[model samples]
Target: MAAHTAIARPPLVPEIPLHLATEITPIWQATEAWLGEQGIEPPFWAFAWPGSQALARWVLDEPGLVAGKRVLDFAAGGGLAAIAAARAGAAMAEAAEIDPLAHAATRLNARLNGVTVVEAPGDVVGSPCRWDTILAGDVCYEAPMTNHILPWLRRLAAEGAAVILADPGRAYLPGAGLREVARYAVPVTRELEDREERVVTLFRVLP
Candidate 1:
């Protein structure tokens, strides 16, 4: 890994530890430059983002929410939520990421945490619901990404899947058609989010 290694305990989700970058900016820049050289997207897998941390924490705490259910961690960077679901007694915990490097990172992190999460192929938008639960974290950071994913997620929710989104006050988050289930104050590296603490909200997509 290009990042300086450290045992990171994310805010609001301390039980699920992660091998995260000790210094955010250097590794972030290094990974970005390296990916650019290879003509790849940003290496978001190098860190345990705050929203993912909160979702993992919430799932671990409320094991009944996912116990014996099939779970899908969408855009699962580092597979934190997927690992938590597996550990929380989900029948199957799968992570789907478009970036190969991020997918590999998810597998590595899952192993470190003593769990197994299958990797799904290709972009999952428009795919029929194959799991009982869907978890999306910090996915609304960009308008294009949110626009592309929100409608599909809404459709899944309408189909009776438990679709949950963890957002850190993104500009594009929907104002309606969702209900807040929980919230957490997640501590994060300022270099990554320009703030030390982020208040993330976990919402259940309503049909």
Candidate 2:
């Protein structure tokens, strides 16, 4: 078995405009069979989820809202939301993922979109630095993860930061206090899971 190494946080990169190629780009992610083919790894963050792609497409449908805001894309697999926020004119865009491979993928996707994305991880949570806006997608499918992240999000929102989540009615999404901002019917492939279709809804955390 390959031993895991200590997690090292990477530096933040600059911001850039949205790319035209994102629309045509095929979002290929690892499925259960695919992971088995490649020899499944312990860390789950190496692969991007279908819900994340759904959130990304939903973000693309909106413009002008994120301009000039400090944005944090939490659990940013493939940095889809980070790239979208940057394209939408976020002043500083950071992609936070705990997995090293996902961090690398975030950087690669940032470059592919001609954007500079900062890579941060879960360890950065509760740090002195605060973002004007925080975005999370497909993060609440698991009860433990949702329980862990919900308090952090609430704390951030309580501190007056704008927090948003794009979820496909995942089992763990809190039933209260999220205002619907937008919705999208995302075309999903079976590359990530059994679900071939999903309706993603964006919500704004109210103060």
Candidate 3:
């Protein structure tokens, strides 16, 4: 995993260092070839996506939101937000990922940032909420994924967990029940997002 990525800080959240791919194509091809599979999902864990970058920035700047709370970074790619929560003095910071590679990357990145992020292995979609705050970044990109996770997230919110979602205008984001909390203009590469920047909106998920 370390062989293909370089240690670098994301553009928006420079305080945290992540193992990121310099280019998308090479990492994508390498992962596919290494797995010996076709039609595999792109390595989302190798890049700090706009949503997670925004979430990390918010948590770092406003530490009280997560300080002394049990925080969960849902669908944590590279564990940017989780690491930030830990740095900001959260009592417990946990990262949940279904992908083993992503879990490994999160552990590696957490260690690099001098933090500890508990790993929530496998699918956690239907699990009962065990966190005080939940940070879900860039999770609504695909329709099927959005459909699969939104209900559980909404349930968590309804159950008194603060479910926060950061979205960079992904197509599958729900049209209602989101109360905007913050917004950020996150810089990105055209090769990945087809744009130089993305305006990421952070919202508190309402049930």
Candidate 4:
């Protein structure tokens, strides 16, 4: 994991250090070669996406929101938001990821930032809500993935968990039941996204 990445801070959340790839193509190729398959999911864990960057910034700036609360960073790429939540005094911070490499990256990054983030590896979609607050960043990009997680997320929201989602205008984001709470213009590289920056919106998922 350390071989392909460098310890760098994300543009929006500079306080936390992450092991991130400098370019997309090389990392993608490397991931494919390492995994021995071309059909695997993109190495989303290697880059700090716009949504997670915004979430981390918001959590750090407004620590009171997560202070003493049980927080979860769902689909946590590099566990950026989880690190921020821990730094902001969350009672417990957890990061959930299906990808093994993402889990490793999260563990590595958490250690780099000197924070303890419990790893919730494998599929946690149908699990009972163990969190007081949940941060899902850039999760609604693909239709199938959006469909798979939305119902469970809505259920979590209905069960009184404050499920917060940060979106950078992904096509699969639902049209309703989101109350906007914050917005950020996150800087991004054109290699990953079409635009050089993305306006990420944070929403409270309403049940």
List of clashing residue pairs for candidate 4: none
**Candidate 2: which stretches are off by over 4 Å?**
1-50
Q: Score residue 24 of candidate 3 by CA lDDT.
A: 85
TM agreement with the true structure for every prediction: 0.92, 0.74, 0.98, 0.98
Candidate 3 — which residues are off by over 4 angstroms?
none
Deviation from truth (RMSD, Å), model 4 = 0.8
Question: Deviation in angstroms for 87 in model 1?
Answer: 0.9
Candidate 1 lDDT over 1-207, as tens digits, reads 724556666666777776777775666667767576643455677788878888899999999999999999999987889989999999999998887777877777777788889998579898999889999999998899988999999999999999999999989998899899999889887778898989999999987
Residue-wise lDDT of candidate 4 within 1-207, one digit each (tens)?
A: 688899999999998889999987788888999998997778999999999999999999999999999999999988999999999999999999999999999999988888999999999999999999999999999999999999999999999999999999999999999999999999998888988999999999998
Please report the TM-score between candidate 3 and the true structure: 0.98
Error of 3 at 7 (Å): 1.0
2 versus 3: better lDDT goes to: 3
Cα shift from native, residue 55, model 4 (Å): 0.6
* Per-model lDDT: 0.85, 0.65, 0.95, 0.94
Worst 10-residue lDDT window for candidate 2 reads 1-10
- Candidate 3 has its poorest 10 consecutive residues by lDDT at 30-39
